[model samples]
Target: MGGLNSNAELRRLLEEIGWSPYELARAVNRLVSPDRRIHAKTPFAWRDRGTVPRDPLPAVVAGILTEARGEIVTVDQLWPGQAHKTEVWLPAVAQIAPDRWLPHDTLALLKEFRASGKAKTHFAVSGNELTSLAESWAFGNHALMSNRMTAGQGRITPDYIDYLEKDLAELRRLDDGHGGELVLRAVVNRLAEAIDLLSDSSYPADLGRRLLSLAGQMAQLAGWLGFDLGRHGFAQRMYLLGLRAAVAAGDKQLGALVLSCIAFQQTWRNRPHDAVSIMGTVQQGLRSATTPRVQALIAMREARAFATSGMHSETSAALERAHQALARGQHDHDPAWVYWMGPTVLTSEAGRCYLHLGDTLQAEQQLAEGLANLNQDATRDRVLYGLSLALAHARGTGGRQDLELACYEAGQVLPMLPEVGSARCRNLIDTINAELRPHRATSTVRTFIDKFETMKKAKIC
Candidate 1:
């Protein structure tokens, strides 16, 4: 309090909330562990002396303010200089008006999204926003837009739509092999072309619906690629735009698919409750339309969220549900997107769930089986799951032999890294590397570390 400078930003925020410094401190302390509680006077120093508290306190204070104000109150807003330390920032959820789903409105939204360029900041839309969007998609009735092209507009045909669909399929295959970073630009370009067709071409009602569906698919792919590259804000926008296109096209199944993608993103970001909530909306909304494959996918995603949240019983129940769904066999009505959903993929995901649940033996068994059965061409999946297996080994209860096996598994993944451009794969590798670092004195661990360092120097891994 004796410092010459005052924390004007902190003071202003407190004033707006009508909170005294002590109250702010009290609120923050309530959110932390008892051992880490702050003194009641701590906020006075922050407000009057320009002292920013350490890592999690600033985040906690900002969260308290955000909940109280019912708006986003970020660490950067409260302490501008500490923005870089913010690990995750979630914006306030915007309410989606019913009119926002209109075809023309959806088109305008896509146009604006295209012009916005790449996201400059790293942030996620609030979980409430995601859940709300999913609920709207599941329960709402969106009319199929009538064709509204004037005379002399560019004409479209089913053949052209077929060609576009094939192209998108090829793009999906490319993403599977080469990962999102290598394929994102191509997906973005294709999505732009789809948007152009929607805006500039005149088509009959059927063709218009197909075009909208195609645009929605491309937008989902772009969103997925953006997510894979860790551009979450950009990904969220793309997903919402895709949802609008799906609604405009009156494709409930596709809307469910997009919702599942959003759920997966939430799960990956460690927001298990949000992921579970979004999946619940998806399951409830798609009850009549879901095929066995689709059912399996949803159950698997729910299992993942449950595992992340340490709900062991719930996770096991969800996994059993996924297995039962898959055992029911595929149907002709299954969407083409579910082509990649099979026993191997399900097993691999189960392994990932077990890893999250800290069941290393189960993780090792499932991941190994999935890797053994995986198609050789599935480079990105192989790399990601391989690293997960390595992590399982590194965390095993066995002695030095387990550490050696972990090094070997990680080494197998390194060669594939150059072909796979997934940031997720790299992040997993980094985790395994961190685990092995403490055992560097072991000969096998030392060798693996040297090789890893060489790859880093060469920008290969």
Candidate 2:
């Protein structure tokens, strides 16, 4: 062990998994090396010289073996004398199951994670893991053990619950105005506080329900911020957390909302089958509790999912249902959360679905209407739909007028990017820039690029 003895542990682990030394080396290289063609001599050297790979490669080796072996393969097992070494983050780090977590253990784990400052350091959920979490939320039968933990010892009041709600509303406003990057940490902090309050206080059952509902809302907001920041796995976990809180609070409507949020994220990830399935579950659950606006919102989301999955007939039907539901919705009867889910939002969503369906004409028409009627205060939505409209025009006939209009719409989105710190928003702009590449010779496109460059110099976008 002094110098570099043979890596007997790695050799044994590879042998146990029926993989040759070269295969193990190939897996590591494929995962770690961008070129993915590391020489087999590397593995030979490690086996003979007892050389540990680099900082993370040892962990990567363990992970590949774990997946293939269908069991937890510790780094120490893969490379002995490394028992004290931590497994650094890797591509599949999010997929690594936490030790001893059962269905009943989820709420406790979520609480413990929120209480731990270390958990805040990274966003560590993968899409597949997220889908699993979402499925559990939708169908799992585990119950929260109790709300009466000894660690929670405070006299909670209605005013305190109201204060939490107020905080949630304010944080949501910041999220809408400034994007997720600026407001996510604040929202997560508030969500943790809400969780604490739920457990720490004794109150009437109604008040307790309200507190739980507040926690659910906060969790949903946190999830939204997670998605906006491009932490899809984290977003999925947050959504499931919110769903659990909502279920515990006896708020079916809130639970449906959380499920719909997951569905939306699934659609974003191009897993339209999961998205559609999740939304169908949400719709079924919401039937008794939903307002027309809420129904419309869910229907539009379903339409988008269907469109993305190439289900043309289902997409058109869902869109029609959304429009019909919206027409029947009354502003006063809608929930506070659904207040923003108006005809304008429906138009924007319909436009999105059309774009996915490859109907640029319909996409442009609905997007234009949506933008025309969008509230001025919706900074993020404006930029998003603006970009979407620009994209629709770009994908259209590519006429001078179409291209110029696309550039104009894209340019209009620039000013707001200063206030919008969302990675998703930045990604949208990046996409628009890529879309306009072919039209670089056009003066309008050139002006758009110049303005964007100026904004970059000013650190606006």
Candidate 3:
């Protein structure tokens, strides 16, 4: 057991945490399903016999240790030399340089991302790092770079810019319908193309600014796709790069848009304070030229942050500002990215905020209105908002739970689940199933469980 195959690191970590092998196994089991549960003695084999646990166990164990220690732990640290197979890769934030947002840095990142293949290491930016980046963009007073003709053969024109913008819009539409997994590679490719043009092409100052803005837009979209796919570290890197591009273009509004995206990711990661801070940076940066729609979008994100942090009064005030901003109507100078930030999208987000705030009735009302008005082609949104509605119904008002209505609402989203490939949507479905498990005696809950299981197995098959 003390020979070449010994896992000294695993044993050391177990000792440091003061956890017995059985305790580690129990922790892993809690995070996984009953059928996938490991034996109580499994960690003994791992630590003493140097046996590496299969598939997700290593990652799960690492996560357990991370939570217990209040720090980041990785599978590689637990089982050295073992191939890591994790659902989501969370790399150390320090591994990514804080200032890697310049044009050459972005090119290198794109090259690395393209070459990394399927087993890419995802690096999450620390909250402090994100805040610093936001502050830099907001107050750095970044001036547009003077036009310099590069030696490469690519030539950019207004017609080309128009075509690129339309192509990006189309990519957004595809993502809305099919989710990130289906569209991520395409987005990366487009972002790479845009970067190449920015780095290799010779254009006038105006065209150069336009190209930079386009690159920022592409980076923002790619970042969002990465987030939707649960590659958060990769998402943050793209977001930082996008912010850099926006600054280079002297596009304060685009920079604010990128910051809002970062704030959204922070909210999802349960760092509401960081989200609120980033949103504040966005709001402060855009105080002069922000359009009504843009303001509404920013306020909605701020409201989400407040809701996540349990700031009821602040959340209400932010939502009111969002609604009031929308009431100002669309401005002629509104950015193209705010095209989707209308009543329907705002209502859905407000519903999400209320859901976080534990007001299930209000959540249900807002989500239902949003769903009813949602475009039929917005399959991913429907699944997300629909699942939120189901949760609200499951929780119900006062002391009552509407199991039947909950199942019905969830069932409505079941068929559309396969149409999109979002991990978030899948996670929400799992959450709903978990919530409904207690009422398994009820026929409605039983039927929903059966259908969900059948669909899950079918996907595997």
How many clashing residue pairs appear in each of the predictions shown? 0, 0, 1
Measured against the true structure, the TM-scores of the candidates, in listed sequence, are 0.81, 0.76, 0.82
Please, what are the lDDT tens digits per residue for candidate 1 over residues 1-461? 33568888788888897999999888777656798799999899998988878766777677677655535677878888754444333332322353467787887866655655443222355556578778877787767778565233689889999999999999999888876665888888888888778777788877888888888988888888888876665676677778888889887777877888877887777677888888888878885667888889888988887888898999999999999999999899987677888999999999999999988989999999999999999998999999999999999754423988899998997898888777788888888889899999999999999999999999876
In model 2, which runs have C-alpha deviations exceeding 4 angstroms? 1-107, 117-136, 139-152, 285-288, 331-335, 397-401
Estimate, for each residue in 9-128, the C-alpha lDDT of model 2 and write its tens digit.
666666787887788777777556576445787877667678777666666666666555534466677567753454243322232242322423434644664676323322233234
Model 3 lDDT tens row, 71-101: 5677878776785757454443333354444
Q: Candidate 3: list runs displaced more than 4 Å.
A: 1-119
Position 371, candidate 3: lDDT: 99
Rank candidates by TM-score, best first.
Answer: 3, 1, 2
Worst 10 residues of 1 by lDDT: 87-96
Q: Please report the TM-score between candidate 1 and the true structure.
A: 0.81
Clashes of 1: 0
